[model samples]
Target chain A: MIHLYQNNGYNIVLDVNSGSVHVVDKAAYDVIGALEEQNEFHTPDTLKSPETAAYLKERLGQEYAEEDLTDILEAAAELAGQGRLFTRDVYGDFIDEVKQRKTVVKALCLHIAHDCNLACKYCFAEEGEYHGRRALMSYEVGKKALDFLIANSGKRRNLEVDFFGGEPLMNWQVVKDLVAYGREQEKLHGKHFRFTLTTNGVLLNDEVQEFVNKEMDNVVLSLDGRKEVNDRMRPFRSGKGSYELIVPKFQKLAESRNQQKYYIRGTFTRNNLDFSNDVLHFAELGFKQISIEPVVGEDTDPYAIRREDLPRIFEEYDKLAKIMVDREKSGRGFTFFHFMIDLEGGPCVAKRLSGCGSGTEYLAVTPWGDLYPCHQFVGQEEFLMGNVEEGLTRPDIGDAFRGCSVYSKEGCKKCFARFYCSGGCMANSYKFHHSINDTYEVSCEMERKRVECAIMIKAALADA
Target chain B: MKHIKTLNTQTLNNTVKKGGCGECQTSCQSACKTSCTVGNQTCENRK
Candidate 1:
């Protein structure tokens, strides 16, 4: 059972199980609550301002000055005591850490092999453009990059390492060497190490599959739905249809041991924009999780899928979620990373003790050992944090990320989705906006609508 | 105090800039034309 209430004209939804309350506008509160609660709704304790203040003081600790602490605690307590977790407690914390910034990327995707056998239309790395320049990252370069990550991550708990390229498997030897080295370092440092690689399935054979299952924690297979849809966008270097080969490999991967180990990621383009039925095919192929991304490239027509096609995307997502839900109901369990919020039913981005740390906690190092904001702008010049020789410690990486105007765009600061979307993708900001500070408007709106759809579906499912 | 205020203003301006909408012409719902709680209110309110 759950409870609903209103404080300061904001509707608060509380889950009795977790004591989690999501705050929203009074209108949203009424609409969602009325629609969701089939049974009677109850109102729980409304902690008064005085009690709330006392709680805040305790939470903030006793070292603070009495005068300032009293005022701060009063405001914080008022919100937390109410169920407006999103609006009050979340926004309160967001506002308080006004000067603090957190890091999102702990490691970087150093493109060890840019040489790929397949030609995927939506490949981020321009296949023909950087072909000759695509040299394999040597063991020496990999060592330096690993050392940097280990040293920085030593201060933290988990460090992430992702491999990228035209296809990361082209330099499988390097990957094997690095994974071995990373395992050694992980043992020495006592830190959590997670590895992921996104690949077109042309090179993923039985041996490769076993290695990825054992060595790499996650592998993102690029398969865009049905054979026809996949073959059209993802073909061989010689322009031959590679769907038959990929399907077998995908099946081998997803069904490997069990469906719990791998995820299938699809890229939608103008060619197959309305392929919702493809989700069924994905489910049949034994993939437990899937991520659908729109093809983003320069000179690519934006409306490949008509603006109205947004509903179709949601329809497909809901359908897929239903299938997974039914599967779970039947005692088969599957988890999807793309639906992290839905599965966990918690905050979208975890808050830090400090403020939003973009460049500090998370730093991206390129194949060339140049540190950047994240993996998205690996080779982009303007987003460079610093080079590897000096290390990011002495440099302005922390300061730049901490003070980078990216977090404070007028729209972002004011937008309700600020906590969830985080001013859109930083990569899109640098690429399309040409400034790190620019907000990704289209993506932001799309994500908000997507979140709304997810919330509605989840609420409906919970009721059923 | 003067230096701190100037730095705060600069930080505020920088925040506003990095977070401003990318100049997109799409009739996207995310244009964020709707006014929010703290718009152009300066660092004082933000603090």
Candidate 2:
């Protein structure tokens, strides 16, 4: 399949199967569009015909002469022969092979504490206990979760387990025990375990930072931005701002792990339309990795991103891109999560087709050991796959999640951002539309703008 | 190695066009509801 769009005044064409992106002229773009439209109406075998050429000339004749139209069609046909355009049925073999293989859980999100100290309004987990009950994952459940990941990993050498919660530090002792347990299991099973911790930084003291720096593979520190913005959105249960308390601790942690994998993750709401300033604030505080994600909630909330905020959000992205370029020019470049696209070494077609490996390769275990697709779906019983003891009792749910891909989504099949986005977040789809394959249109717009901005940055850097 | 052609000055100067939701004239809420519901039936079959 192929996708076409306009970005920064340039006509861009993406060949999904070939993983090639071309910047074509208007004439070529029109010809490719006509060919794709015809293929949609008819069959692939009947793509080339004198009548096809006539139809193309009739549609695009005012822009191009008959000879130029013929040449453009011939070039498009050549691309088709090379398996760039009109590439249908390319995923059948891969699908068959995947079906015959065992579905293993490679990564697990362990909810260390169902309770949190902070009262972030946009907390997806209903302030950490998932709005159902307040609890903490015992050492017994945590150890069993590690064992489950190792047993079901199926020849995978490196497995990932993230210490997640309303605040993982709330159950600090159990987290320490699980790390030690994971190390013991790794030695016994000859597998490697990589642990990550996501914290709100309220309980990040010297000891916690030391343990995180020494043992954890990565740490996700949650701090929104400027003191007022963060405090307004992520206030403590006592009704005080957490920015001052956490910023110094986060700065120290970031400084201690000079070259380690850590991100200062922030969430932007309707209140902070100019979130580029927040990103710059993190950069100024000496953070090397930053991820600023939009808040996910229903539109009824006052802080949810509304349709009117899109224009300002797009402008903020452009401003962020400019800041990134300036930082690179000054030799102090920091990595923004959204702009880090590996165009040269993109994911293989199978990986792109399957989207994020939520159910099949990844799962989240709640405090009581109930399993869900990911952290977002922890409380939803319909998403429950199984517990550590039962080991994936709902294989049908797993199969359904594994079957969801861009190939299954009708609108995504023709999007220029299909390979990059892979049909968006399944949790969002399930929450908004109650379907795994459906995509949020707001996310689609945001992602397309980001892709366009990234491409423009690459172009500028190339010319520089 | 595959070749990727970057956007140049001439190509960047061409007239820009909008497709999909970018060109829709309806309100954002109405347009999004319509666009996101395009393939609901097909999605249900897969589920």
Q: Pick the candidate with the highest TM-score.
A: 2
By DockQ, the best candidate is 2
Query: Which parts of model 1 are misplaced by more than 4 Å?
Result: A1-81, A85-105, A128-132, A299-337, A342-359, A393-398, A404-407, B1-47
Across all candidates, what is each one's fraction of true contacts kept?
0.00, 0.05
Q: What's model 1's overall lDDT?
A: 0.52
The most accurate candidate by lDDT is: 2
What local lDDT does model 2 show for residue A68? Answer: 75
RMSD to truth, every model: 13.6, 9.0
Model 2, A213-264: lDDT tens per residue?
8888878889889888999999999999999999999999998999457888
- Candidate 1 residue A10 Cα shift, in angstroms, is 20
lDDT of 1 by residue, A1-464 (tens): 33455422334454322224344443334433432332223222322245443643554435445455444333323433343222222333353244453333355556667567888776656662242365667777887887777776535545667676667888788888988899988888876667777787888888888888897766777778888888888888798988788888888787884776456777777676565556556866666666565555554465344455666665665565566566666755354333433223222222311222345544555556667655555565655677556676434556644554324566565444454444555456655677656665655555554444344334434434
lDDT of 2: 0.73
